[model samples]
Every structure is written in structure tokens, then in C-alpha cells.
Target chain A: MVKLKSNDDKEFEVEEAAVIQSEMIKNMIEDGCATSVIPLPNIDSKTLIKVIEYLNKHINMGKAAETGEEDDLKEFDEQFVNMGWEELFDVIMAANYLNIHELMELCCQSAADRLKNKSVRAVREMLKITNDLTEEEEQEIINDAPWAFEGPEIDDTVN
Target chain B: MEYGLIFLLINNQKLEIPQIILKSHPLQSKIVPKLTYNSNSCKTSSNTSVDKKVEEKSFATAEVATLMAPQIPSNESLPKLPQELITAILVRLPVKSLLQFKSVSKEWFALISSSVNGLIFYRIWFNSLVLWNPSTGKYKQLPDLMPTQMVTTGYCFNYGFGYDEVHNDYKIVALFREIRKHCVGAKIYSLKSDSWRILDDAQGEMLYDGSGKLVNGKLHWVTIVDGGWSIMSIDMVDEKCRKVEQPCYGVDQFSLTLGSVGK
Candidate 1:
């Protein structure tokens, strides 16, 4: 078993097989650097819980095809990324810190899919991003592709 | 993280064009060099110009980075992702979405444009061609082909871009056919000389009209030879077209398309 401590001073126990899926932790284990509880300063307890759930479910991923559980794993992944923007961002950061390749791809792809049809205003609002471009600069970008900026297909609702 | 290594044989000898590993993870720094600009030959005038432009642009990046540093959210508010994490998300978006999202912010505008590796050869219309490098903010408009304006209802035009290792130049190959006159022609444009020439010795009829795939110092295409589709490659060195052995796919009903992966 491997013990992981989140930034909120919460510690959780996980199986070695499951935790080893994280390349960062795996490397530490290989180098005898993970003797005690592994500290994750960047991830909070809530996000760490979510990541642990993912790692547990994705354990023995190579044997999933043989066991006919590939569809189950796929469905779990589909449901996993169906999170709010803020929550998804947390998961992405956690995945990056842990160096979990599949989770990072899943979260990033979900984020991209959500932002695919969103208008610039909707995107800024959803992510709470402050647009630092001057009006003239913004106008220049719009002028280059005026049709792209004002299309009916562009989604305006912030999800 | 799956690593891929693709091997190619050129002139009956192994030729490895640098390892093109796609390190998309935010933590790992991407090491893949841009194939559009080979870094080895720094003495070339165009190469030196590109280096100067990149240096200037990187200086601008540092200022932008400092300007963006404070805007990042701390512990209280919604956690804002780091710049690299944002880049990981943006790279997966479609081009249409990227175009719309360019107005999101100044950083987004720069990120979307500068994500391109090097030169992007794009065709606006049938006749007009453009080569743009977003990082350097440089663009060049190629001379419009008069024959493209002559494209009628039934005729088609195919174009391809690739690097010629032997001459150390970039080349754009264009194949066009005029149905009314029953004439087929091919043209090659060299970036070194900034000129175009019609290939007099090119067997345009046998050479299929399609986008050429650059692999191992050659541009490959599917050709119709004796009523059967066969693989044909054009040597970048001599500009000579030669037949290549096609992959043995047991089923003849499958359609064939040429594509190149890695740098």
C-alpha cells in the first residue's frame, strides 16, 4: 500500500498496483524515494479523492480487454470528465502533477470539446478570463474572420 | 504515454530524421524540432532571418509572461490553470474553434497563432497560395498560377509541399490537368530560388493527381499504372519518379490513401 497526503493535510491509502499508474509516484518508488507518505502540495483533498477514485478504477488496465471490462472503463471515463469547468480544471492540474497520461488526455480533451463551439464571450465568461486585448486588436481579429465571430452555430451559453 | 519510433530506408540505407516524439504532457518540455526549419544550417540567409525573428518574439514572450503572472488566481477564488495546462487544452481544439477563440484574450490570440511549428502552406482559393509562420509573424504570398483560373467543372488541381534534403531547399509541387485540351502538366517551385518551373520530362499521365506525402527524402503518391493503383515516389534529389512496392493487403476491395506521420 502507498500512502498519499493531499494539501489539506488529508492522507489516504491506496494499493501499490493502482498508485503505480502515476508515473511520478512510480518513479519515486523505483528510486526508493517513496518510503513514507507521499506529499502532494498542489492537489487538495477533494481533488486527490477524485484522482484516487480514477486510479483505483483504472487498475489492471492492460487486463481490462481480456476481462471484457474495456467498455466499462470507457463508460467510467466518459462520466469522469462530465464535470464543471472548475472541477475539470482541478482534475487536469492533479493529473499533470501526478503524470497520469490517460487522465490528462481525458480531462484536456473534455475541456477542448466543451470550448469547441463556444463564442469568445462565452469562453471568457465560463473560465472567468479577463480579455486583455485592446478594442482595436480585437477588432482586427474579428475583421480577419468576421463570419467566424458572428455565426449562428457558435454557442453563447456558459456551461 | 506511448512512445513511437518510425524507421525509413532511403537509398538502401537507414536514415533517421530526428526522433519526432510528441511530448504533450504539461510537465515534459517538448523537444521536437520544427521540420520546416532545419536548425543545423544556421549560415543560410533565410535561416539567420528566422533565428532573428524567433529571438525577438521570445523576448516579447517574457514580457507577456510577466504581465500574465499576477492575473493567476491564488488559493481563494476558482483555480486558474497554468499557461502550459491551458496550452494542452487549446491544442486539441478544432481549427474553427481556434479561429473563434482568438478573440478570447491577447494571450489566447498569441497562443493559437504561435502553436504552429513553423511554416503553414495554405491555399485560400484555387489560384492563391500562402505560407505563414505564426511564431515569427511572417508570411509570404506565392505567385498565383494562371492555369488554376482555367480550372473548369471537370478538372482538378493537386498541390503538395516538402523539403528537398539534397538541395537544402523547400519545394512545392503542383499537378494540374486541363480536360478540354487533354493536357496534363506538373510544376515545381523552389524556396531557395523563389521561382517555379514546369517539369518537361514529368510523365503527368501516369502520375496520379493527388497530394504527395513526404517521407524519407521523397514525395510519395498513389499512381494508376496499367489500370491498377500502385505506389510511386518522386526522389527529392533528382526529381525522378519511380515505382515503389505496395503494401500487401490481402483484400483488393480496400481503398488506398497516402499519409506521412512523424517529422
Candidate 2:
């Protein structure tokens, strides 16, 4: 078993096979730094739990594909990332810090999917990003490519 | 004991005790950094003022224990990720979303504009010409040269599309002859400015065969003048129309097609 200690001091006992999904943890284990509990100062307990759940579920990914469980794994992944924006952001950061390639790809794809076809205002509100451009600068950008803004697929209102 | 068991059940079912309690834990307080947008700086400052507020708020409610709810981090807690992470996410986004979100920040605007690599030319509805970038899926349509009146009047016009490397622009050259006046005229449409302008010096009695070839930043067309075929070339850079002498073929009396034998 591999022990992971969250920033909150909460300790999680995870299987070595499951925990090794994280490249950072795998490297630490190889270098003998994982003799004790691996400290993850960048991730909180709640986020760490979510990441552990993902690692556990995806541990047998290769066997799942051979046994035709790929669809089930894909479905689990789809439901796994169904989180609020703040929660999703935490997961993305945690995945990045852990160097979990698949989790990073999945979370980034989720972020991109949420942003697809959304208007400038909606994207700003969704991401909680403040638009710092001046009115003239904004207008100039709009004028430079007015056709991009004319498509019917664009959603102007914030959800 | 029965009442205590019921309370534990309620807490487990409704609040998920471990998750909620973890929020108030001391080490968890430092997990997320504070994000502040400064107008003058136009950048996010890592000053821990907002982080301190979160720590104090979480710690102040720690004594309440079971009664305290899980603290959902505010939007400002969204990590100010590194540039590479932001790029990874942005690159996966569709072109339309990228274009619309260009106004989100100066950095995003620069990223999207700089990532545009190539242009694709296509025609829509057989008449509307467009310049598109397949990688980005962003396209701009060129203005229509033939108006409704010209179409209804059944006037014939020849067109050639070529690029002007000097100005970094695409241009469409049109050659036409007035039916009643028998006067030939030429006009050029610039994709950069999205406008058309007539070439003032393009006045002649030349008869074009309605086909044009674009080569070497110029438009070439075969025209018959005084019962003989000659090559007419338009210099897109200078917007001038001039005739080129055809090679001697011993007066063989045959039609010629204008083509470029690659240099």
C-alpha cells in the first residue's frame, strides 16, 4: 500500500498499483522518497480524495480495454468530471501537480468543453475572469473579425 | 445512544462529515492561493490578503465543528495556473470560442492571434469567396464584385484571385466590357480593406475570353485584338493592366490558352 497525506493532514491508504498512476508519485517511489507517507502540500483532502477515486477506478485501464470494459470506464470518466467550476479547477490543479497525464487531459478537455461556443461575457462569467480590456480595444478586436461574432452557434448570455 | 446514532446518520447522509471537517483543518487553509486583479497592474497579484481572509473564516468556524458547513472556495480561489497549463486548455478550445474569448484578457488576445498559422480559400454558394484558416476554422468572405444589376443585365465578367506579398493581402481582379459602349474596364477588390476600386488607366477595346490565370502575383488572360490573340497581364502590385506580345507561331490561325510554365 502507498500512503498519501493531503495538505489537511488527512491520510489515505491507496494501493500501490492505483497510486502509481500519478507519474510524480511513481518517480518518488522509484527514488525511495515514498518510504513514508507521500506529502502532497498542493492538494487538499477533498481534491485528493477525488483524485484517488479516479486513480483507483482507472488502475486496470489496460485490462478493461481487453475485457470490453472501455465503455464503462469512459462513462465513469464522464460522470467523474461533472463538477462545479471551482471544483473542476481544483481537480485540474491537483492533476497537474501529481503529473497524472490522463487526468490532466480529461480535466482540460472538460474545461474546454464548458467554454465551447460560449460568448465573451458568458466565458468571463463562467471562468470568473474579469475583462480588463478597454472598450476601444474590445471594439477593435470585434471589428477586426466581425464574422466570428455573427455565427448562430454563439451564446451571448451567461448561464 | 439511539439519538446519537440518528444524528451520526444524518451527518453522514447529508453533510459527508470527513469532507466538510477537512475544510477547516489547518493545513488545508494554505492549499489555494489568493487571486487579486489590479487594474493598474493589469495582472493577478499573489498578495495573501484574500488567503488570510479564507484562513481566518475557516478557523473562526472550526469550533462549531458538526454544525459548520463545508466552505466552498470562492471564484478567486481558482488557481492562477502556469502559462503552459493555460495554453494547454486554450489550444483545445474551438476557434470560435477562442475568438470570442479574446476579450477576456490581453494575454488571451495575443495567444489566439499569434496561433493563427495558415489560410484556406473556398467558395460558398458558388459565388461568395472566402479565405479560411482550417487549423483555426476562422474565415472571412470577400465582398461581391458583381452587383444585382450586373447579374440581371447578363453582363459577362472575368475574375482572377491572387495574393500580394508586399501588402500581405489577397486581391480579386475583374475584367469586363460595357455592352453598348464596347469599352473595356478593370476593377480590383482588396481582401484587406474589403473594398473594390476601378483601375482608371484600364480603358481599351480588348475582348477577353472570360478565363483568367493567376501567376507570379499577376492576373493573365488571353484577349483577341484585331482578329489576333494576345496575352493581357495585370500587375496586382501596381494595379496596372498591360498587353504582352504573344510568341510567333507562323500565323497558324488557332486559339491559345493562357498558362504559366513554372519558372
Candidate 3:
């Protein structure tokens, strides 16, 4: 077993085989190995837990036959990420920190799900980003530089 | 309880990608300094939060060319905009940017690919649809589009999109190419009718690739014509493909130019 400690003094234990999903852990195991504990100084308890779940699920993807439970678990993931904005954000961050590729794609797809059909003002508001453009800058974006805002994927008729 | 590894996005701010968090991500041991999400944001937004409205405009394509992305931290902060607002912003970007933004965060990418929101964004894509009402003196971005015909045929996507607010409806014109070896045609789709609309006027030509502009609800493009492959255009609203009439006083016919005409 491998034990990962987060910054907030939370400890998570995972099977040694599953822990190797992490490239860092994989290398450590291959290089004549790890012993007592793995220190994940940047991750919190909650985020670390999420990472473990992803690794476990990923490590089991190929065992779907005898397990007969991989698809169902994936459904759980679909529902799991369907949380509110703040929770989803944290999950995304955690997935990135842990280098969980599948979880990152899944979470990103989830976040993208929430942001369809909004205005520039709404996008600024939702993403917590300021316009940061001077009046000229703003005008230039909304005005002179109409080319920049043109989305080739979007039609002109609806707006 | 088990959970995913987290990358914290302080305050839901775009520029709030804390340095400590980056150094601690799961891949940090492998790719710390090489990642440029924060540095890229610095180049774009100068580490300012989207909370207080800044008075600056965004960087132009020429100034802010996109680069290949580094590793992603799944826990990065998300934009606080509602689903619709985010879709609006996505609609304004080129498909390439939308594709890139999908990697920045999971939420954004999902919305871009969602059936409804993706549909809306697909409707008003390419360049901004600047429909000058002249009457209201105000304009708003249109919603994205859906590929009605592509979904119906269960075929892969071959489509185009635009808004027709003038007709009191959002318009989407999707194209589906024929599979026959000797013959070819395009099928169109519209959001207003929520059904597949077919078009036989493609001239078996593809001018949709050019930088076309929509003015007064008509689409125009600078493309090659039939005789010599010169500048050509097609009105999405009317489906009338026409060649641009260039100046004819001994000017070079090969030198065709197309630009936006403001009303």
C-alpha cells in the first residue's frame, strides 16, 4: 500500500498497484521503490481523495469483464462531476494537480457544459475575469476589431 | 472517501492561478516550469482578476497568437458566468480557440460540445455577427447553432451557421455532402424550423473556407469563380451564390478584394 499525505494533514492509502497510475509514483516504484509514505504537499485532503478515486477507476478500466462494473462506475463519474460550479472548479484543479488525464478531460467537458449561450458581460461575470481593457480597448474589441470576436463555428443570424 | 486530485483556483478568478498550487499539481514533479497557463495569463491579463472590471480591450489575434498548451491542472478556477454567457463568448471565438479553451478547463469544453449550447455556438460562429438594427441602436451576440440535418442522417458533420434575426428567428444552415462517387450536393439545416433544410446551389464548390462577412443578414465571400476561380460569394439567407463585381477600368480581374461593409 501507498500512503499520500496532503497539506492539511489528511492521509489517503491506495493499493501499490493503483498508485502507479501516477507517473511520479510509477517511477518511484520502478526505481527499487518507495516505503513508508508519499508526501503530496500541495494537495488537500478532499482533492487527494478525488485523485485516488480516478486512479482506482482508471487502473480497473481493463478489468471490466470479470468486474462487470466499469461502465457503471463511469456513469458514477458522469454524475459525480455534475456538481455545482465551485465544487466542479475544485475537482478540475485537483485532477490537474494529480496528473489524472481522463479526469481532466471529463471535468473540463463538465465545466464547458455550464457556459453555453451567455454574453460577454456574462462570460466576464461567470469566469470572474475583469474586462481589463481600456475604454479604447473595450471599444476596439467590441467595435473596430470585429474580426477577433467572430466565431467561425457560430452563425450570424441568431445574435 | 475517494476523490480526484485538486488544483485550486483562488476566488474563481481567471488570473487567480496561485503559484503555490502550480508547483504542487500532480504533474508538477514532471512539468513545473514548462507549464505556461499562469505565464500565458500574465501575458494576456497581467494577473488581474475578472472581479473588478478593467477598462482594457482584449489582445488581437495578431498580438495574442495562441500557442500549444502545457499540462493542465483539473482544479483550476472556472469562469463565474452562467451557462448561456459562456456559450456566447465561445461563439465569438474561432473553432480553434474554442477547441483550445476546452483544455484550459473541463466546464468550458463540455459546453462547447453540448447538444444545446454547442448548437447555439455553432449557429453564430466565425466572425462576430454584427447586425446593425439601426432602429434600436443596440446589438447583442446571437446564440449558437445545432446540426439538425447531420443528426437526422446520423452522418458526420458538414455544416455552416449564421443568424437571421431579421426574419424573426435564429437561422442555422448546415450542409451535408452526398456520398455518391459521381455526384455531390449539400444539405442545409435551420434552427428556426428545427428540421433539415436542403440546398442545391453549392455549385459543388466550397467557398465557405474563405473569410466571409455577413452584412444586412447576407453572407459574402472573396473566392474563385467558375471560369478562372475568382472571388465569389453566397448569401446564407438567400442561398444565392454570386461573384463579386470588381472595378472594371483596366484593373486586374485576378486582383479581387472582399471586406465588410458597415450600414
On TM-score, the candidate that comes out on top is 1
TM-score of each: 0.51, 0.49, 0.37
Top-lDDT structure, candidate number: 1
Interface RMSD, model 2, angstroms: 7.8
TM-score of chain A of each: 0.96, 0.97, 0.75
**Model 1 CAPRI rating:** acceptable
Quantify all predictions' global Cα lDDT against the true fold: 0.59, 0.58, 0.41
Candidate 1 stretches with Cα past 4 Å from truth are B1-76, B115-263
| Candidate with more favorable, higher lDDT: 2 or 3 | 2
- Runs in model 2 deviating more than 4 A are A157-159, B1-77, B114-263
What digit string (tens of lDDT, one per residue) describes model 2 on residues B49-74?
32233234333433432121122233
Model 1 clash pairs are: none
Candidate 1 per-residue lDDT, tens place, B34-84, comes to 111111111111112213443343334333222111232223355766544
Q: What is the TM-score of chain B alone in each candidate?
A: 0.51, 0.48, 0.35
What is candidate 1's lDDT per residue for A52-76, written digit by digit as tens? 9999999988899999999999999
Model 2 residue B36 distance off true place after TM-score fit, in angstroms: 12
Q: Where's the lowest-lDDT run of ten residues in candidate 2 chain A?
A: A23-32
Q: Tell me the TM-score of model 2.
A: 0.49
List each candidate's DockQ score. 0.24, 0.22, 0.06
Candidate 2, pairs of clashing residues: none
Worst 10 residues of 2 chain B by lDDT: B2-11
